[model samples]
Target: MADSQLALFSALISLLRRLGKLDDNIVLAYTLERGKKLSMLSLFYVSNVILALFALSGMNIPMYNAMRRCVPIASLLLGPCIYPQRTTSSIIMAIILITAGTITAAQGDLDFDFKSYTFGSLSVLTQALYLLTLQRMGSDNKLGSYKTSSAKTLTILYVNSVNCLPIVFAVVFLSGEYNSMKSYPHWSEPGFLFALGVVTSFACVFSYSIFLCTTVNSALTTACVGVIKSALTTIIGMYTFGGVAATPLLIIGQLINLSGGSLYTYEKYRLQKPASPKPTKKNSSIRPRKPKFTKTARNSSKTTF
Candidate 1:
């Protein structure tokens, strides 16, 4: 673990210098200070990926998706313990609905295996932890005076990629995949390399799209898009993966699951947004009294009033 962390830190410095896109000093300082947190974050990330692979391999696409959709429920249950946020009734109801959908979907899973279900559930839990860690770690870490949201988002992407690399490489080597890849005859083929490059390029674009979305809109919008995208994927999975029986129960359950997830995101946003300071009765009542001053202040700042 120590070696992994050290390697990650070294790679981080190299990337920051090579890319010349992030503030190296700020990123390195944060990486060094929060070493333990990042290590734990990586653990969750690696675990989630491994478990998700197992879940995906063992389960059908639709069931796998349904199980993974429970991440929000896990987040709702676990988030307040760490960050102490307000949890509303609507949030709880949303979780309940999501849970019911998962259960209903499970009932319709003709090829269900307990191991796959368990692994999928575990993947969702670890993924929730990973996401929570990112939120907490990113939110608290200051990137100095010149930091923008885009910079912060890029910082996360860089740090995460670097931090996870050592462990990922270690896993691949230890699991014998490295050796297997080296022996694969077609790995050196141009078509294979071109396909790999195209996939890698798309992945980079996807990451940038996410960050750009945040810059163009807000985190809430990005998250809402994510929820909608998941729903679309689930729907597509049902059709694309012919093995999955499009039974009425399965369809209804997936719909319910998607609806619940969607509703949760929308409600979560609405509930949280209301917490921000708005014009209160007192502020409104005092507005007329300070009308001249308010007008002057607004004009001088030329900002939202």
Candidate 2:
């Protein structure tokens, strides 16, 4: 267990660096437009690619392994759209939540296939970093022109989607899995069921929407959203798939995550009232500004005098 956590922590650190770099790049790209910026559009294109993978990957763990590779990139790409100012403590709390959730996920199937485990760890790490990046990007930074959503979306699409060509190539060349794309039913196919299910997308999309919202604390927003996604996914997976049972530990992890996020939210906004200055009476001669009408009449009387 300790070894797994250490591995995950290492991956998360790397993922955080990647995310920070991606966010910085977005800011840079806004300041200076380059041909490579065009490639970022691929981030959006990969949405289709991810969907295609789900269609053919079948109901198994390998597809998730494939998704793990993409998680970090996807999450980092989304950094620009989140709220601002991710504090160090908040980042730590987020790591704990995501890591706990992941540990819960890894409980069974001790097959210990190093490759699959590695990829899954990477994917979770990437996702956690992405959440942090969202916290970083959620702010309205007055310094950069690309601070807004239009610029952010464009930047991510260009960098992640277009730059994803290498990944696309690797997936196509390295794996026979992607070769028979025709084997999977297209969107037009009748009664086609998507692998991993729309629930995943729904949860993700909802989380992303929350990221874009004007919340008081970016960390709390992320934590709350993560908990919702993790809980819902677990519930659906346990109930529908009947593949795994929910462990008490997993429930406890969710509670802890929720508690952390709620605390942050309360801390960020609760003290904002400024104490109303205790309503102290000022003894100074300086008076409040008179009404505009009264001032105007006073000026006219002064002119007459």
Candidate 3:
């Protein structure tokens, strides 16, 4: 049901573009202009999503979130390749803390699975690559003509969405899921339609936010945002969801993860803030002495004359 819905959603976007309704999605033309330099971005994105879905199957909600907590670290490691930015000691420590938290939480998982962890790790690496590529494109001097961050993000989202169509279809076809819904016969059901629409809408919104944030901020910062959100989701899952052990360790772990992400965000903001110009020394005020009422300075010249 879900796979078929995804295929249908992709088809809808492609159809809109084919009808020239989505003039904003110039990814295909842009890709052509770039001589296919950006062809790998779609591949990386598709791999990232697919690996994430694979990871989700082997783990519960809390564990799933915990597994993805390492994305920030992955982004950091991969970031320098796209943009060589220096990392601060605080950021390094934060990454370590987040990794520790993830490990701690994973140890307490009630449904630990090696295959899930492996897939999640692959997803993290792929996501890091995708993010860095997208960020580089957004920050490219070639794209500096974009009027605003929103415009740049929109171009990225449109291109990525359109490019993802073929990849999504290929995956579905290979998995034999394109016809899965035919067997289930749930396509016309009201509940199925509603759920599909809701999921697809949220996914679109999520993709927009991802590109926008990644464009406005650094890839690492966007990854940190995800870590922070997932940390909250993990905390909520502990009590509400039966997938987790709900142990004190999990609480501590999420706290550490959350704090780490927050610290990274603060550090990034501080670094990006323009430094205040140093206060220049004010010129010493040299007030002229009031002319003496009985000035004697000219006496020598008058006497000489």
**Global lDDT scores for all candidate models:** 0.65, 0.43, 0.76
Per-prediction tally of clashes: 0, 15, 0
Instruction: Give candidate 3's TM-score.
Output: 0.81
What TM-score against the true fold does each predicted structure earn? 0.72, 0.49, 0.81
Query: How well does candidate 1 score on lDDT at residue 147?
Result: 53
Give lDDT tens digits, candidate 3, residues 54-162.
8888777778888788888888877777765468999998888898899888777767789988998998899889888888887773532565677677666655665
Assess candidate 3 and give its lDDT.
0.76
lDDT of 2 by residue, 1-305 (tens): 11122233334334655677445434333222332443333333333444444432333332242223233223433444543243445544544544454454444333335554554444444454544543454344432456456445333323332245455656566666555654666746544445323444454344335445422244344444444445455556656655344566545544554454455455545445466556878878988886676776777777542
Per-residue lDDT tens digits for candidate 1, residues 91-164, read 67766777777777778778989888888889988877766666665565543332555655555555555667
Off by over 4 Å in 1: 1-16, 19-34, 142-146, 204-227, 268-305
- Backbone clash total for model 1 is 0
* Higher-lDDT candidate of 1 and 2: 1
Choose the strongest candidate by lDDT: 3
Q: Once model 1 is optimally superposed onto the true structure by TM-score, how far is the C-alpha of residue 290 displaced, in angstroms? A: 27
